[model samples]
Target: MALKINKTAVKEAKAGDKPQELRFEDGLILRVQPSGVRTYYVEVARGKRVRIGRVGTVTPAMAAEAAKRLSVKVMGEGVEAVMPVRAITLEKFIADVYEPFVEHEHRRGKRTAEDLRRSFADLLSTKLDRITSRELDAWVRGRREDGVKAATIAREANQLQGALRFAVERKHLKVSPFDTWKAPNVPQGNVERYLTTQEKAAIRKALSDRDRQQARERASANKWRRERRYPELPMVADHVMPMVLVLLNTGMRYGEVVKLEWQAVNLTTRTITVVGEKAKAGRGRIIQLNDEALKVLTTWRALTNRTTGLVFQCDGEPIKSIKTAWKTIKKMSGVENVRIHDLRHDFASSIVQRGGSVYVVQKLLGHGNVSQTMRYAHLADEQAAKAVALLDGHKRGGR
Candidate 1:
């Protein structure tokens, strides 16, 4: 029955077998449940109902006030106007807005965009505003449960946070959900893989065997081409071995090496310039080439017969990947559990073991900070001990 609803009427409301609705003017309702729990609801329109709060929490006066305001809003501005502020879904925002901005702004933007999309796949469908810090914690816990490395998880999380921050900057979001999120601690002393002497020798032998095999294959193909009167291909048909040598010697990142152009190479100075745009450090640096590296590049340059364009290209296009070749090389060499990137680590380790300072290693590796080079500090410690032992030998001679 419709009646004048007040605090006393709401407080004294009783429940029976079914829910009892105490209706009032202006479409305000106090619903009393079977267990005697009362909640305030408002029928802003004829069929639509909106829950305000419970009776104890939302008093009759407050419910009445809210109902009146909602009614007035619906009458003047329509139902959509009274609805909560809508936010775009995370996936939609990233694909439509953030990614496009990143593509225009950053060199590796496409890769970064793809990584974020893949990493935050679970949260893609969720609305941006609904993604709280608690939600991120659950996501991180899920990743941990899936056995994803802490460092990898931290990197992906940071990328997602960066995308959200970009959204806020572009006015697509009010604030980033990850603004207060703390990344899980990554073990700083986690040592990188350094190839052993036997492994190194095995890899070199494998490369030599592979190069000989390739030479024979090239000769056979050239003979077939000559018979068909087609143009003979170059001796250096692929970039796999030469690129590996450069990576091992120069400690150049895969991207930097792939993007390297002939213009940056100085045969006289035996140095190669890593352009800032292609470099991870965002600043250009010159890398001095050792005898093996200089010879490899010199032979590669002569064989390819190119004075300009990418150092590693296939059919005049940049080589996308050498995964298959690297895998084959590893298998042939019996080198287990070594990643292609580990060659860079091996390069740094060689210097450290030879008593080169971490500061020098940092500069050679183009690390923005010395802390990155500190992962090889243990190797330096061994070198330091060896140096100190030489002083002991000198003291013995003096005695």
Candidate 2:
């Protein structure tokens, strides 16, 4: 029975086995359960319900007043108007929306999403609409004051802009705070640093020295294994030399080389296919093995007992990093201001120095774009000069 629900009537009303709802004026309602618990709700529209409060905890007059106000709001603003009041926070948006979209939709790595999360920690709790460009500027300024490089800040800002755009696209936000915001400018081209021929030789000598030491250790270990000694000699460094050789030869990133499996290498074809997740570009590329690279791989493969899985392994597993080994090699080799990645640059530089076209270098290095190949264009200047010199031999009217 629909009766005007007041506090006295609410107390008097009893529910049967099923729960009962008492309707009041202006869409106010009191729901009574079989156990005699009562709760109030306001039916703003046909299918839209908004909970106000419980029967006793909130007096009937107060619920009625709230319901009346909400009814006015619904009449004036419509049912869909409550979204801003329930807008998701920045943290929720990042966790629920941005991260999933980046990892799955964008096909980006987990490291990228993690970096964005870390970079935006300061603004994680703020609402999307409340986040202003001024706030972003302050964040950039704070990052700069904290000794972070401008390039790094620029990357973080670009990530932030992407996230904001994502939010807008999903309708979680009406407009991006970064729509007109200016991110810090980073240098256009990559910082190219290639090892000189002498530097390369020094590094190779250092690696060879370590290799000799490792060989001696291996021989001793083999003797111990044959004699069935208590503990066979511990496994010495075997991966570093081969890994370094591959990096220097093929120009593969450290990640690509470390993750390389035996299946990727085809000795007959003289090619290594960097495929699937192993490639940075999300596509496969073939790396042709030079004589030196082929020799190193052949030797390493001959010595390796396990023919399957990662070509480079430490303790029968893929090696995550070569930082310590590389640091020691760099120190011993006396090659200053060169990184492991510079090996790839050196490889490209070597190709360009040998009169190889930039297009050839690009194909060899597996670069996605020619622009990435253009950084080593400076290496071709001598060849260009030589080409011009050839024209001088046929000159008849030039001064």
Candidate 3:
């Protein structure tokens, strides 16, 4: 039965064998359940129902006001106007919208999305609209307190800023809170580490020593196994020597070298084509093979029985990690400070020291920008000096 619902009538209402509802003006309705629980609802002219509150929690007057506002919204008076300003928690938007869009529409990899999630995990529960420059500053300060390097923190902050900007673009946020924020200051130039000639020789000697010791152990085990007195020993595969040589010569990143396939290498052309997917820049690059690099590849190819697949592998599969081995090798070789990436630096440094142009080094290193290649500029100072010397009046014969 339709009636104007008031507090007195709501209390006087009885629970029926089934559910009973009292309808009021302006889309307000008081529903009386079989258990005698009364709830308020706003039913629009279009028959869509929106729950207001419970009978005791919400009075008739409150329901009437909500009903009026809902009726205006249903009439298209200003319904679409308020959606953009609606605030959502950062966690909800990232999970419901941002991640899906990044994974599907943006064609970003799963790992990239996962990294972003980890970077912003602390702020996930905060409301998107409530985030401010001060919050971002605190986040940066926290990262510094945790001993993260400025460069790493800056990269993570840039990624977070990108995500916030995406939220603004999707109308999930009115504006990016981090739009005015500044990332932690990073060092202006790259810190290049390279191996000296003596250090390089020491590393080679260490690798050679390891190989000889393993070979002897294998030979001794074979002799004992043949005599039926001892179990056969497994032969150890040596990859460090060749891998180090390739990195030192090619200037390819460790990831690129490990993921290299046989098909990408052209011995006849004396070149390696680092594919776009494996390359850091997301673009393929050609690396010309020098004599040392070519020799290493030839030697490694002949040693392996597999005709196809990765150029470097363990148990016929691509190597997953070489950290432990690299650490041991570095310690034994007395090259304590050099990292694996320094081999690439060594390659570039070697080229520039030999009078190679910055452009040439940039091309060889597959750098997307010349600025990355400019760290080796100091190595080319002698070439610049020689050029200036050619202009000396004493050196030139009346030129």
Task: Score every model by TM-score.
Answer: 0.55, 0.52, 0.54
- Each prediction's whole-model lDDT (CA): 0.83, 0.79, 0.78
Ranking by lDDT: 1, 2, 3
Candidate 2 per-residue lDDT over residues 263-319, each given as its tens digit: 899888899999966776666789899999999898888888656898988777767
Error of 3 at 374 (Å): 1.2
TM-score of candidate 3 versus the correct structure, residues matched by position: 0.54
lDDT by residue (1-399, candidate 3, tens digit) is: 446656788787799999998888777888899998989887764555778989778888888888878877777854433333667888887778777877886656455566666666678788888889888887775554333458778888877788889888887788787767666564323447767889989988887886787688889879989799777766756787788789888999887898899999888899999988788658678999999899989888888754579989877776755566777788788887566777788889999988889999888888899998998998799778887887796656775
Q: Write the per-residue lDDT of candidate 1 for residues 1-399, one digit (tens) a residue.
A: 567779789878899999999888778998999998999988876677888999778878899999889889989998756654448998898889888988999998888887776667778899888889888888776554333557788888888888888777766677687767776564333338789999989998888888888889999999999999999987765688899999989998776888899999998899999989778647788899999999999999998889899888988877756766877888899997776677888999999899798999998999988998998999889888888899889898995
Candidate 1 clash pair list = none
Error of 1 at 126 (Å): 25
Better of 1 and 2 by TM-score: 1
Top TM-score hit: 1
Q: How much is the lDDT of residue 268 in candidate 2?
A: 82
**For model 1, what is the error of residue 14's alpha carbon versus the real structure, in angstroms, after optimal superposition?**
72
lDDT of 3: 0.78
